[model samples]
Target: MVGWLLAGSMLAGACTASSPEVERAAPSGASEATPATEASSQPAAQGSVGRILEHLEALDRIAQRNGGTRAVGSEGYDESVAYVSRHMRQLGYSVVSDRFDFDYFEQLSPTRVERLKPRKAYVDGRDVRAMVYSGAGRVSAPVEPVGFDLRSNDHTGAGCSSDDFSDLPTGSIALLRPGPCYYRDQVVNAQEAGAAAVILAFPEFTRATGVLRPTLLSGAGIEIPALAATDGTGVELARSRTRLRITARTRYSPLRGVSLIAERREARAGDVLMVGGHLDSVMDGPGINDNGSGIATILEMARAVAAKEPDAPVRFAFWGGEEIGLLGSTAYVESLSSQQTTSIEAYLNFDMVASPNFVRYVYEDEIAPAGSDEITDLFTRYFNRQDIEFKTIDLGGRSDHGAFIEQGIPVGGLFTGAEMLKSRRQRKDYGGRAGASMDGCYHRPCDDIDNINQKVLREMVGAIRHALFALLTR
Candidate 1:
């Protein structure tokens, strides 16, 4: 999954619910006891937790062989694609590898920020850090705070609009608060106002002890540099009218990524039930649990369903460049013709389904398209039948489903948890450390095979398998 922070507001109103009991017989040839659900009538397909773990082990070995990462633009990602595509082809599914290019940004050297008038050299990575996609430049200018509401703890609308910069002097460094809006908007507004550089400050109430690293997402047409500072550094710069010298060194290049799509060889044209997950991991880790879990689950489901075609055409996608953003999925959605887009009945996304400290989370129906409630009910009913407690999470544009949702396609999925800390109530429900992050190794080097919770992984795989069978047969 992408390393972006999960929205805190979404968690506050999360609902934990259970449905009436429904029994489903376990599929044949499954070693572990599977949930008995409404879809048990479709018994031709069988799920294997062992197969899922085997897939994960293969991905781990691939990552280990290729610098411990399956990140986009790397050999591991390419090998991952080869692995999945080979399996799909061997399973008698016709596969296509779609390629797309994106702007890749890398920092070439340490960024420097200095208080020129006070002769104070601010430490990089502590006082301030260069934003991703920040332009490389050196500038010395007086700082100007734009649209900052210092008194209020609410950090929103600052430098988000160009009107906020109307009176700002040209060549001045704009100091602004991180927003309800994107860092891209903030930097663009400052650039349009002829600012020499941009600095985004963490909210005063934020508990961050180090510099905040923000991303502009893209470097296309951006000329001036951008940086992020701690709350203290921001307040001092805003209050003291400091003249600052900023230097940022970065490189932007075009890179290609490929997403793999597979469907039955003899599949007919009709409404499609699309299921997918990002295949790429963050550069910091092998991403076994971050997404290797999702990939493994879906791959196993694909294998199970390969024996018999469903009533509706099913397409399986292994997306690329999701860690950088939702690049692969977004591009795929954009590439589809309007008629093709509408032909997609719904999408099921599985990302980060196995966290050490876990919760059985269903994507909240409120944020999804109209028919999504049915999809949500499908998983919840399965969980209820199995006597598993589940919560609804509002994942607003945080995963591959975001692309499908943008095209008015109903989307639903399963997620165990991510970087968010598990609550006391969640701990009671799921039985893990309450104060610890759901996935302690999220986006880090330690997110290897051992980072996974096999119990949650097996359960989630079962849930996903149940949901897929239910969707296909319904």
Candidate 2:
């Protein structure tokens, strides 16, 4: 999931409650505060990073054995589901899979871009990649500049406005550049302009590694074919006088994802506290840090919590299809009845918790559900007591928490970082490169076990354990 900037006032000393009130403590128990040192050194907490590394290694193996990815509908993802569910069952929890259908995309053939007039074909993976949600088709037409004119050497942000299409030729592929709008908006504008297709040429700064890495449009919908081109290819296409032939074809079919849910044995029927993380990864990589870290941490907490089975029920959810959007989580939330919805005391999400270049982040919702502020405070206080620096960032509608928030269920979570670059201040606080992305390998194939920061993983996992201990024991 993409990251968003912080917003709203910092959570104050208290927050408003919006959901049904949960009993302060289970009928059979009274909550007690435990020190971090004591909470983290327990047997269950031993080798937190070691255990996380093991899961990361296992996920890497699954990806290696099954086409190098654990993406939804793939064997790797299925095996991953089985792995998590099997372990939860062994730990004496009732495990179940929630199945859902999502629009699945697979490239039928390598996408190609040829400058017919110039008689040159750019390298496929290096120079261009078909946009993940682009339509399956082949088109041969003149490449008309839309957002920026080559001769003028000026960016008009053309595709962002419909007026830019005034003199556009029908049946020509529109060429655009990254600017003030989303790729979807550009594509939609081009589609409305009678353009047969669209190509978004990356600016020099975005051409990391000089490759046109594939980009995706929200699976929500798109009718025209779109492709991402390297800056060099864009320049070449723009200067070439002849038409271009773009062939892009992808197979669209039904894809199934399974979310594993485990509830402690014979717990109370009152408010349920749901803790979850997405288990599925992007198509290109093993996704160790993007989500493997979150799941592994949650799994550890689940096992420890199960060993001491409390009166209040706790549900652990390992969501699927989060990479495409919050499909799995959304489906689960939509399945719940109004009563079931209210029965959920609070929801905590953990995604990308262990980026190599990391910063400890707690999701802070200014206007949040009933127990969200408490959750944030729990994390903040834990880090503070440990002398570890942390920050409260806006949730930004990015992960599984989004689904719960949509239903007015209080939600909070942790995120080390994704693609966002770290500032000088954050670097000083976190001790990482100031200009680098917190998770440089995010969504890339290199996000294997080696991409994790063991120290960050250990601290984050310890905090996760502390939070769970607080929720279950309280």
- Which candidate has the highest lDDT of all? 1
**RMSD in order of candidates:** 5.7, 7.2
* Candidate 1, residue 95: how far the Cα is off, in Å: 1.4
**Every candidate's lDDT:** 0.78, 0.73
User: TM-score for every candidate vs. truth?
Assistant: 0.83, 0.84
Residue runs of model 2 more than 4 Å from their true location after superposition? 2-46, 116-121, 148-167, 177-186, 201-205, 209-223, 230-242, 310-312
Q: Mind sharing the TM-score for model 2?
A: 0.84
Q: Mind giving the per-residue lDDT tens digits that candidate 1 earns over 282-304?
A: 76579999799999888888877
RMSD (Cα, Å) of model 1: 5.7
